[model samples]
Target: MPVLRAPEVRRPGRGDPAVGHRQAAPPPDARAVRRRRGPDGRRAMSEIVFLFPGQGAQHPGMARELFGREPVFTEILEEFFELLDGEGKRLRDDWLTDDPAVPLDEGRRAQPLLFILGYALARTLETRGVRPGVLLGHSIGELAAAAFAGVFDLPAAARLMEARSLALDGSPSGGMLAVGATPEELTRFVDPPGRPGGVVVGAVNAPRQTVLAGPEPRLGEVERALEDAGTPGRRVPALQAFHSPAMAEAAEVFTAAFAKEELRRPSLRIQSTRTARAVRPDEATDPGFWAGQVAGAVLFWPALEALLAEGDFTLVEVGPGRRLSTPARRHPAVRSGRSTVIPMLPSTAEGTWEFWTAALDALDALP
Candidate 1:
């Protein structure tokens, strides 16, 4: 892991016009204008924001090490199960322990469990004195991010996530294919004249990576068209067609469920995948935004661009796998030298602690 230090803060050179003009102005005498200082007369600590990864990033044994090492992690998992039980869905206890053979990958178990693991990891990080100044989550990960940002209680998020997963479970069996081409190229494949079955572009992950979701049978036609157009692609293991028109019914169900729950403004900033722009805390609770997330394209590129525009950052993908981090690193903005992106689950290895510790070390080493 490489650690890059923030550049030294210095006054502008004497010849700089801005500096010369400021110098020419009368010195501020008001106490209110003075910089706030700590007890030791030093500036406040710098800030670090966290980005949480979504569903496709989950792995079988994510965050299991933390549960064994920390009682808080175990307690949080217990609370999550209790919440699910209240919703008439009891997640098996073995799921929390990270049993390698269990079929926890099913949407019903995977969504809530991923939320629990991410929450536990975030809590563990906080116990270690790492606090986020801002937060953003990708797709399903947004629910976890919302809880972390104080938009809703952990139990509320757990319940809502349960409802969300139930709504999506076996609704429509569709596939998500990742295409290696510009958005236009991918759109051409989906919107070809007289195409038999319909395929919708799900997410524009980067300049060259776009995900398409449609009926599994029609996937072959889309793939063939992409190949003929010089764009290579592969099918992702998503059970449902997320972020496409195919998910409209699921989105409607989720919207109704969300309407019954009271949502508060987030304590921290969040970026919307729908608008690819920064959303105010109040704006995040809007039902329309949540609904749009299901049937709209995830504008990840613009969201990433907005974060980078804030200046350099060290992005740690907090989730079960490295799917999001891989695409993020490949994005032009990320590759053009703005921030450091690392994944908490860095390996497909068996031991969970080793993987977590390695990721923690990488995060700590960031500037």
Candidate 2:
């Protein structure tokens, strides 16, 4: 049996007490000067974007601490679990346990739980006067973003998540491998000059971090190629190949499941990492666009760049671990001190409540 361990959590940086000590958060600059204030004197959300992470970020016990400690997060999350019926109970039971019968990376296990947690966190932030100006998500995280933006109500999103689980269940055995190479450098192995390979670049997360995906056998070939080139590659926890041609059939299954569901235009700004732009009204209503996400490459770095180009914005990673924050910090805007990244929970499961409060306090202290 695979003994599930705590998710790989990065240590909080030193000095910054809010959201793990990092560089003492710089004093709020110009952005804070023009910020709007609420009736009770709390800062209103402005120039802030809430980011959500997808599959690889999840682990057992994620958000367990927040469930009971924070009323808003607890109620909203419990409602999502209730919508899932028996499956919700099962996921909740496994989530709080140290060991799970199935791995958390499996789509069936990961997708629903992630969607619930991400949506709950967004709502939790809103109640604390941390409403976001925009929403962004990577891969499956996009669905959660849409839900928060009102593209789909919670029940509708849950149904789509269920549809996704069914589609993944029927997909071929495949997985993703994260390589420390640029997408251009990895292209040769994916489809060398004369020979065709199953692998495709699943995501270009950062300048040097890329994710490759395909059928298990083909992925093995790419992994061996990486070994030959003396490059490092790590397996991203997943049972089905997402964001690759191998997901074509699964995409069809997923689309058909939600063909008749109503999808509304987002009430707030929401960016798509898949398209690397703000989602359009037509795209919001198109079921195909959402379904195609299963077989589309995630242009996270490009999307983040595009957003940063518009202007500096505070990025809040509202999911488990620091998966999205890790890459966001590499962006020039963040590195140059123009933008900031705040994580709501610590990487480790142990100090989640403490970290959660600290992060909120930090946000309140901004400006």
Candidate 3:
């Protein structure tokens, strides 16, 4: 395969997000992609899996550069913000500016932004004729994946996300921490089943990485405990105790808030991180399952394992950051080159140049 180079930057007119940054050529359509043949005469990119990152992926200035530069992304995101009304504008302003009034870590800001970014990226890819064979998401990213898969229209998904944000606002105060230990290693730190306030394994990210969520002091205490146990934990940028009992009330509120939204069968396959498997046809339409995700542990590691067991895939990180891509790179299939990881966007606010290079590389690398 030939290495593609970024084209010369072209400054855009007024109100454009284009800062004269290098732009990649448009990607090939799905039919063209599928027809590609590798050196060995086998499909170079047989399966394309789009991985959407959940919370802890949001940051100020995320996708700001692409907002106006990419037409499809700009349109879909603007439409989504309109559906959200005033709160939507606030989110847009917060995301585009360096100084945001509300921190992105707060559930209200992070959840919707991440969802919208993921949704927009997926849609933009489709418009350029790049479609995924399977969709997987970390937490709130699943909502994005579902939206892209046609489980719910964009409007409904936006409504559901807004409802989720409001619900989280009413939930108990808490936080999350990423521990450098396996779920088995952290079993002693997790609360017993049905427990209400202590820390719990909120996510199983990889073989040796897990996330813990809990209410205030207990969560803080666990962070300290993990450090003392020789496995220090890094704080996940979040303000609510997601995937823990502390979100029970929030989950109920979220379900009730979007009770009337229509649910449809997904047109594409969705590998659910909450259940660590492919979402059943029934589960796809279950409001409870979607709502319950807010308070349920994310079984990301197992979900990835399930996908790997099925076949080799070119895992594309469709969202803003490398949160999902990093752990996925450690998977045996990827390490052995049976699969590959491609991040469609840059991970940080300052890597706008990197974004173009990465996107172009992805377009070229795709079969």
Order by lDDT, highest first: 3, 2, 1
Residue-by-residue lDDT tens digits, candidate 2, 244-355: 8888888999888768688899998888998899999999989999889998889888889899998878898899878998888888888776677888775668667666
Please, what are the lDDT tens digits per residue for candidate 1 over residues 243-282?
A: 7666777788888877877788887777766677777765
Pull out the clashing pairs in model 2. 13-21, 16-21
Off by over 4 Å in 2: 1-46, 192-197
Superior by TM-score: candidate 1 or candidate 3: 3
What shift in Å separates residue 282 of candidate 2 from its native position after superposition? 0.3
Error of 1 at 195 (Å): 12
In candidate 1, how many Å is residue 2 off?
40
253-349 per-residue lDDT for model 3 (tens digits): 8888657888888999999999888999999888898899888999999999999988888888888878998899899988777777777766776
Q: Give the winner by lDDT.
A: 3
Output the better candidate (2/3) by lDDT. Answer: 3
**Poorest lDDT segment (10 consecutive residues) of candidate 2:** 22-31
Q: Candidate 1, 9: how far from true, in Å? A: 44
